[model samples]
Target chain A: MANKVLVLGEVREGALRNVSFEAIAAAKQIADGEVVGVLLGDSVANLAGELIAYGADRVVTVEHPHLKSYTSDGYSQAFLAVCEQEKPEGIILGHTSLGKDLSPKLASRLNSGLISDVTEIEGAGEDAVFIRPIYSGKAFEKVKIKEGIVFATIRPNNIKPLEKNASLTGDVASISVDVQNLRTIIKDVVRKASTGVDLSEAKIVVAGGRGVKSAEGFEPLKELANLLGGAVGASRGACDADYCDYSLQIGQTGKVVTPDLYIAAGISGAIQHLAGMSNSKVIVAINKDPEANIFKVADYGIVGDLFEVVPMLIEEFKALKVNS
Target chain B: MNIFVLVKRTFDTEEKIVISNGKIQEDGAEFIINPYDEYAIEEAIQVRDAKGGKVTVLTIGGEDAEKQLRTALAMGADEAVLINTEDDLDELDQYSAAYILAEYLKDKEVDLILAGNVAIDGGTGQVGPRVADLLGINYVTTITDLEIDGTNVKIVRDIEGDSEIIETSLPLLVTAQQGLNEPRYPSLPGIMKAKKKPLAELELDDLDIDEDDVEVKIEIVDIYLPPQKAAGRVLEGELSQQVKELVNLLHSEAKVV
Candidate 1:
């Protein structure tokens, strides 16, 4: 009999995060038997059909009130139960904030090996090898499970999601686990996140730096990001300069992103800032300083004041969108 | 109130990675306390100061790691511990690292534990949460702010770009985020004091564990740097012409538009 693979379909704001489908897609590439999708939330049974259509052979939902907001205690209890019951040969989850926090605990509890932030997978079934970024994407390491179950976390936007096949559907089963003694309780969630696309998952990002002189300086970057339907980010210099909140910071000690198009405006790229975004697919730099390090990593560079270049580029992008 | 901070010595982020023989060459690499752990140590010190307790800095490495531990002590940690795994294990993974740390901690009187959100070298933010799971305690990762009153604690953790306020209690573990606190440098007086501070070193044999107990589960098949994106074209012209050229290039060559 072939081994069964379990895919954790992570839900956020009532919908399954895109990385969930990407994980299911990854599980399909590795599964020799049935690929099971597991959903955990207070009300997530309704989201199971999409997982099935995306490639899950079956869906399991663990519903409990305490599971609504993510607490390691509650989620681990619920997921561990499904793992024991199903005895899955493999487990896959998204390497998001939730996955990063949850997977290690689950992997530890199961006494299983975990390959995290995997950007690529090779081979199939037990022979599969996982490729993950080490040293903050400075280097790549190809790892494999020497023994025991295959457990891994895929970085968001790195892997491709399987296309939906509406003709494909499966049964969605519900299970209950006793969730108590949670040492941590969420009091509230304060959202300072920009209403724009999630930066990590965004296809394009317009990032600013110290040259963005003031808090109001980010407004133009935000406008450019909005025009491109992308997200706005900042270098630590900009964040440190108080031009923007630390939430928008990207660099060595900040969020690492691999957006399709990273437009760096007025940012003299430091190695620290480059550490977070050097992996971006197509980097474009608009800086007045021709000698800026950002130009070295960029696919294209424009030497000019960002105040003038950004607006002109935004207009040009607008025209291109119209023509398309 | 007894606080513990987990520290690891890692390559400085500024250093260019030099890999040879499929392994990161560390012969002369400058190492420092993992930057995020500095935040953890700072937080531990502040928590200890306010709540009337001592902070113990703990790390799992060889004798060389004692320098980082002493640095933590100089930053105000009450004591330091170095679990010398050099002779016992050739390589350490997150699983074994967590297992050994948990085993050592399982017997201690721990009121609070802290660690960096992620190590700069490994870049895996797993040890703190895994240790917490092994010890069967609650944990919050990437915490930006923490408040404690009696046995109750409130934390603000960074979830991507947003914040989640959580209520928890001791004994709890939290992984420090970047903005958690400003880590203090070791003062000359503090450095002198750290010389007298206790730094307890132990080995796997002392912990009653062997090679098979906490074996590494994941095997690294290969290690190499990603192909660096070569420097591309730098457009030159009037502002408007440059904008037009960039748009054309993004569309025709890049196709990312």
Candidate 2:
């Protein structure tokens, strides 16, 4: 029998998170039997077609008013009930904030082993081997679970998301959740209002370090990111000094990003920072220092002041836009 | 509130890494308590001092890691427990280590458990949650700030730049991040006092876990150095010319323009 892989679809503001698609894409490659996705929200059934488009064969929707806001107990209970019924061969989830909090509890309830932040997964013998970064992305360790069920939490951006196939068909199953187990309640949710692009999911990331010199220096990076329809990122140093928004910081202590293209502006690459985004497909470094460590790993290096280089690049791009 | 902080000894971040024959060479390197775990120890001390409770530090490593256990004691843990095993066995992943630690804590009085978000060396960020699962406790990761009130713990964590405040009952697990607290350096008297503090050493047999159940299922095939990075092209010209050249490179060559 082919192994069944169940993915816990994460939702934010009543919408599917990008990582959810990434997980489904991964499941499509690793699972041989079926792909079932469990989603929890007040009215998440509406997103069923979206999940199917992303590769889920069946979408399980657990709806409850209490779940309108993300309460750990409520979300976990809903998913747990589904697991009890499905008894999937393997379970997958995003290693995001919500998934991190809930996956352990679910695993504990099922008394199963969990491999979190897995970078890759492949079949091995009766079970699957999960690969994860060890020693701070310095090495990879392949872990195999010799137990009843295989459980994994995948890091965001580790897999390329699959494109939606127009003919994909999905069946939406609505289920009710037990609200009694929910102990905590969310009073309010405050979102960072300035930008729509999430740095972790952006394909093109423009990151600045302390080399930017000042907070105002990020204006051009932001403009360029806007022009490219991507997001801005920053090194830990720039975030510590308040030169850029803390949300943009990328490193071991901050968000880990693996975008298609990563541009490091005015940043001397530190090991901690490099660990987060070194997996990016293409890296571009712009630093005045000829010996900046970033250039050592960057695919393209421009040794010059970012203030002078960034504005001119922006102007040239704008001219290209006008011409074409 | 009773708190237990877990610490791991790993290669220091500043140490220059060299890959020899596809394995890390550590002939002359120094190891220390993972920087993130120090925050866990510090938070445990602060919470214990404020609420009048006991803090026990736990670890699973080789005999040499005893130095880190002593350092945790010097940093103010009331007691320390070392789950000693073969030095080569220390290569066990976080899931294996967490299983051993959780099995040990199963018999102890533990109301709250703390750990770094992830070890600096491993950077896996999975141990805390895996341990919490093993212990059957609620788990919170990447906590930036925490406040304890009676049996309830309120925490604020950044989720992709948006902060979310999560409230959970006591006896839960929390993994500390870098900004949670500044780990205090052991004072002279503290170091002197820590030398005399009791360090309890326990073996896997002491924890009474079945070694057969935790056998190595996954074996590493090899570890190799990533390919050498390609040298970058230095775009030459005045600032304007350089910008135009960059635009051309991006459009014609790099193709990300």
Candidate 3:
């Protein structure tokens, strides 16, 4: 075995996403030898040192001018060049929008197979088993790579990144590839800018459903979310009812979140909705219906009207903060 | 213009998965066109209507898939193709499925291809890009909006919740994300018209593709349901007291606050 593993560090808006470090942690778990990190973009040289602090044995960067924004065509060319240069036996990437789009093309170019969105890895080296959710977290499967390279895309917020050790350092190597023939162009961007927190990575989530009544009904939930420094989420019911944009939808067809604290107000736990959030660490369900399916999975259930209960909880939380 | 949409028949988004004897029990399961694929199909038909082209819905499955193909036709697709894989193969991972689809599409003058961002059953979101790579075409994924004029194309892709505007050209493959467009239901007249729509069925031999060349590369070791959550505790008594207790519990017991 070549025993070298390659991990792709994802950079969004000039900063390294937490999952990039997490991918390095996961790569170290599955690699028997050196865990090398790869960065692509116009100016990602500064991030190589960050990767080294989090356990990357060395860093390889491709700083092509065309690699400023993520184009599948551009990234595939840059990454494939790195693969040829390194010839790593294993590869790890975050299963974000970029990885989901890029890894498949790279796998096809490599004549390899991919295990996408893996949540856990067991054992080390080629014999490692990757566990991934299927059927929107209702079921899980254990998969193993059977041919070519050990390629996998890991979901964010699952693997813990190696602790930052400023004392640790590694070599940084910059490489170049001819990135041309780009068929896609980036014209503009529209950022949601609703909350600073990304929903999938939020530690606490304040979510609403049809019981929130209307778009204005989400105001309180948003207030509480702002107070708690969390993100706002909505069930498919809320989105379909036109109360909120589908971008806020959280369910089987929407974003899947595993926050530490999930306060679901008026959201009857539809199977699809549960599949997205049932993994939250501490679920608090406030619904008028005592038998709302959410209560089944929640750690604490308040059988009352959310409009009333949520306000009171907010006040009480605030009071607690004051008294402390 | 030539446009193709890759469709898959999957368990309904609301259907509860039942695993029996180490396998997903599919008997009596209500299957529908993958919800995301519906977004792709609707976009395909809309593109064809604007650009003057044929919209073909293609899938790889058994005869049972004809029902889905008919559904696509009823939704305004001009034609359908079912590459039946039941007899020649038993299982399909992303790699083999992409291989088979690319094999069938290799000879066609493919201008644009649309597929769901991710199939709910597998949720890998791999096949479309894989097919594009195998055929040497450009691709984009999770596109919420698309526009075409002559050979020039533009797209709005969803990133987390933000939107990125992109420009591209034809001979492209794009995977549809949500909010592309509101999918239209198959009308009664459309269903009637679909009965007469062309649906061609082929096999591995039909494409001169050796089944051995498309062997699955990954092995599924096991499948099981996630652990069941313990029944929750429903608070009783006064509203403020309940609020007080809940806040205290979240702070002291769960340590999440």
Q: How big is the positional error of residue A179 in model 2, measured in Å on the Cα after superposition?
A: 4.1
What lDDT does the true structure give each of the candidates? 0.90, 0.78, 0.91
lDDT of 2 by residue, B169-190 (tens): 7788888876787799999898
Q: Could you give candidate 3's per-residue lDDT for residues B94-198 as a string of tens digits?
A: 999999999999989999999999988888999999999999999989999999999889999998888999999989999998889999999999999999999
**lDDT of candidate 3 over A158-264, digit per residue (tens):** 88899999788899999989999888899998988367678877889999999999999998998888888899999999999998878888888888888889999
Order of quality (TM-score): 1, 3, 2
How much is B170 displaced in model 3, in angstroms? Answer: 0.7
Provide TM-scores for the models.
0.98, 0.91, 0.98
Ranking by DockQ: 1, 3, 2
Docking class of predicted structure 1 = high
Mark the regions of model 3 whose C-alpha exceeds 4 Å error after superposition.
A319-324
Provide DockQ values for all models, in the order shown: 0.83, 0.46, 0.79
Q: By lDDT, rank the candidates, best first.
A: 3, 1, 2
**Roughly what TM-score does model 2 have, to 2 decimal places?**
0.91
lDDT of 3 at B167: 92
Q: Name the runs in model 2 displaced over 4 angstroms.
A: A121-130, A242-247, B16-24, B87-91, B216-222
